[model samples]
Each structure stands twice: as C-alpha cells, then as structure tokens.
Target: MINIVYRLKSPKFFEESIDEVELDGVIVRPTHLSICQADQRYYQGSRPANILDEKLPMALIHEAIGEVVFDSEGNFKSGDMVVMIPNTPFGEDVYSPNYSYSSKFRGSGFDGFTSDLVNLPEDRVVKIPDDFNLNVSAFIELISVAYQGISKFTQMAITPKDNLGVWGDGNLGFITALLLKELFPKSKVLVFGKHQENLNLFSFADEIYRIHDVDDDVVVDHAFECVGSSASQSAIDQIIDIINPQGTINLFGVSEYPVPINTRMVLEKGLTIQGNSRSDRVDFVGVVETLKQNPQLFEHLEKLITNICEINSLGDLKDAFDKDYISKFGKTILKWNI
Candidate 1:
C-alpha cells in the first residue's frame, strides 16, 4: 500500500512522502492526532541540537486514535475504533515494558502515527467502545501517562494522604488532576497554576489556587509537578515548601535543562521524588477500563481539548502545528480524516 507521511524536514516545515507499506499485521487509518509538547519541541527546534540533528525528517505524532481497515490476525473486525500504543518494545525483558532499554517509541526515534495508514501489531492497539468519541479517545495515551505516574506513586507512597496538589495549568496538569479525583474521590485535589483564566477550566479540581496566592497554611500530603520547561524548578520549589514531611512527589513534567532541587530540604523532610515518562500497555488498559467504568470522566476530559483543526493537506498540518505553537492552554488535536 502507498502510505502518505508528513515529515518535519526542518523547524516549522513539513514535506510529504509516499512510501509502500506491507499489509501484514493490522492496518489502521488515523482519525485524530494530538500534538504533544515533545512534538512541539522537535518541530520548533527547541530540543537539544544533537538530538534534533539525529531525529529530524521524522513523522511527529504519537497520541492518536484510528479506525481499523484490515487485520491479518483477525483479532479485530474491520471498522473497529482503536487506540495505538506508541511504545513498541523490541523483546520481552526482565524490567517493565516502558523501562526496557531497547524500546522503540513512535514519534521519538521511530515513525509515528502521522501517516495516512499505520501498520501496527495487534498487541500495540487497544479497541475502544463504539460509542466513545475518537477525538476524546486521542488523549488516552496522555491520560495513561498520568495514570502510570499515579500507579507508581501508589507503589511508593507509604502513607495514605487525603490532600493532593497538582501544579501547572497545561493539558497534563488538567488530566492529572481529573484522574486524581476520579481514582481517589475522597482526596482533596488542589490545582495550582499561574493563570487564573486557564485554571478556571479545572472545575473538577477540589480547589484551584493561583501559585502566587497560595497561603502558607495550605498544605498537601503529596504533590505532582506537571509544569515543564524552565518553570518546573519553581513548581518543585513550591511543592517542597508546602508538601508535608516524608511526602512523595511525582514528577510528571519534562524539562530540557537539568532542574535543581533543594536537597537540603529533601533530606531534612525525608521526601521522596519519583520521575515518570511514557507509559506501557498495562497503563493504557487501566485507563480504558477506568473510562469504561466511569464514562463521565470522558465528559470532564473533553474540556481540556481547547482546539481541534482538520488536516486535509500539508497546509492544514502546518496550520494546526502553528496554532498549537501559539496556544496558551489546552490540547490541540488534528482531525486526520483527510
């Protein structure tokens, strides 16, 4: 089959290429693709120059939902809606799937789901309910990231906490806060952001506070740092100050530069900080099952999608990326039906 792929030849420029693909496994046509901050970093040349030089001329979308066109394995019927798991492990290992050193992830070192048709192994895709919206389903991978972080926190957290703090108003923070509420309904989930306007969108959070306005009396048993980039350091500082002693902090953000932490405070408080990156199939399965059991979570998640642009041509693809570049909040999704 002739596959049309959008590749980033340089910063803010894309070239379309036509290549032949073997239809051996499951063939999926992308219905919706969501641009992640990491994708933006690559497109804008914000990543390390060496890394960019090595990984450019690559397709740039990992978070997506697709419709099954054909399945050689016959595990899924034609026209089935599925979520593509971006992390493709080379082989089984003693460590966790995502932790495997030989893992090949789409949109990073390998081609992603930005092509007109993606050929994936049956194990790499999960079927969703027919009634689920594909646009919202595109966020499953991102939601699963947050789910994985929380899962890791549960394993490490020695004490149960009633209050949880999430920092950042971006899509990651929004999703993390919502998931925290859904999974632990009794816990008070507080969201701290720089912008009140953007923070207002987090209606699901138990309490929303401006980072500057948070009182000294307010404390959290645990915290999640969803603020990435240069702002991550500040978020971590605030978490260190407000989080209870012996608290476990989950770092879910990505920063290009090395972030400095208050080791003195960490030692004095006996704090534990854990870092999380891409998730595995089990995380995806957990998210799907949670959404299936609590469909209302989907409705709440829809609020995070602030913009959706249809990509019918190369021009449309550039426009979507440009719009996301300037977007101050929420997730920008590319409707890839074209």
Candidate 2:
C-alpha cells in the first residue's frame, strides 16, 4: 500500500511498496489522518527531527478510530471497530526509559494514520463498543486527556466534587465539557471563551460566559485550559480568579512554547495544576464504557464533526491541508477509502 510519509529532514514523501509495519515493531497502515497542531508544526519545520529520515517517517497520526481488519495475536478479529492508542513499550526505544507520553505517540515522531491502511498492533488498538459512533469515538484519545484532567479534579477532594470551569472553546474544550457533563451529571459546569461563534458551538455547559463577563459569584472546584497557546495563560489566570480555594486546574492543551503564568495566585489559592497527554488503551475502554452506559451523551457528537474528505493520491492530500478548507472543519479527516 502507498502511504503518506512524513520525512523529518526533507519534504513530505509518499512511498509505495514499503512493508505495512516499520522495522521498529510498531504495527500501522495509515487510514485516516487529521492535520493536528503537531502535524502543522512538523510541516512548518518548527519541530525538530528530520521526518524524511527512516525513523521519522515511521508514521504521524495519534488520534485515530478504525476497524480491526486483522489481528494475528487473536486479541481482535476482523470487522471490529477500534481506537488506536499509540504508546511505545518500555525498552523499545532508548528514550522510553520512563514510558512517558512522548514515547508512544505515532505521528509525533513516527508513521501516522494519514495513509490508506495502518497496521496497528493488538495492544495499541482498543475495541470500541458495537454501537459506539466511529466519528465521535475518534475523539476518544482526546477524551482520555480530558478524563485524566478531570480525574485529577475528582482526586483533590476527599469527596468527589463536580463543578468545573472550562477555559477556551475549541474542540478540546467542548469535548472536555461534554465528558464532564456525562461523567458528573450532578456537577455544575461553566464554559469561558472569547468568541461567541466558538462558544456557541458547545451546548454541554450549564452556562457559557465570555471571559470578561464571567460572574464573580460562581466558584468552580475544577478548571481547565484547552487552548494550546500563550493566550491560554490568560485563560488560566481567569480560571484561578473564579475557582474556589484549593480548586484543581487542568492544563490539557499542547503549547509549542512556554507561556507566563501567575504563580502567586496559584500559591495563594492552594491550586493544584495538572497536565495530561494522549490516553492509554485502558482510557479508551473506560470511555467506551461511559458511551455504552450512557448512550445519550453522544447526542451532540455529530455536531462536533464538520468535514470528511476522501484522499486517493498526493494531489488530494494537498487539498486536505489547504488552510482555507481545513479551517472550516472542526475535525478534518483524510479518508483513504479510495
């Protein structure tokens, strides 16, 4: 199969006749690839490592939902819908000494899901429930990050508390709020964003307020910053301003550079800061359980997916990155069905 390959040192290359899996022991055959912020950085040369190098082209997609066409280990059978959880095993790579989040990301430094087929390993694939929506399930990896962040929030209290304040109104922000709503039905949630157009996209929150318009009386027990930029610092500051004393703040966004934060207030409020990364297979399983137990939580997921395109060759692939087209899509997936 011909696959879209990201060569770190050179331009993006599509290679044909290569084996389905890399020699490093990672199984993958690219299927659908989303141009995430990480992909964008790689394309622009902002990120290090030569993608053209054999190691870098290993593939690029981390957030993917697919079907298990084959599994030699008998862990899964053909026709099972699954979500790929990319994580490098211990000792697999010299850098995986601690098995941190960076060790297992496919698209981060290896081959990704932007190809016609991704031959993922059994352990990397999480079987989705028969009734789970594929499109919504694509957000499972992301939901894991949200889940981890919120899970931290639940841990801070001797008793589980639910009130949450979500900062930023991007897809991550919206999805995090959705998971919070489903996971903690009794919790009162508030959403803060600068753009009404973006804020209006989500309906999960009990109340949505502009950053400057946030009410002073509402004290949240948990807060999150979903936007991955320096701008998020302001959002964090806002979150700290309104959260109750000892509230936990979850920073789930991917920031390419460092941003200034107000440590004094964080200390004064006895705040707990938490950061999360792509989830594990266990996280996917938990999310599937949530979806199975509460089917109604998916009611608005379809609204979150804005576009899907089929890519046959390199030409169509370029169109996939055309900022004009992708900007309008909340989740733009390059489908390799053709």
Best-performing candidate as measured by lDDT? 1
Regions more than 4 Å wrong, model 1: none
Off by over 4 Å in 2: 1-17, 20-33, 48-58, 92-102, 158-162, 323-329
* Candidate 1 lDDT by residue in tens digits, 53-119: 8998999899999999999989999999999999998987797777788898999978888898999
TM-score of every model versus the real structure: 0.97, 0.85
Model 1 C-alpha RMSD vs. true structure (Å) is 1.2
Query: In model 1, how large is the Cα lDDT of residue 124?
Result: 92
Local distance difference test, each candidate: 0.90, 0.67
Q: State the lDDT of candidate 2 residue by residue for 50-86, as single tens digits.
A: 4334444444456777766556666666677777775
Tell me the deviation in Å of residue 101 in model 2. 7.4
Error of 1 at 316 (Å): 0.6
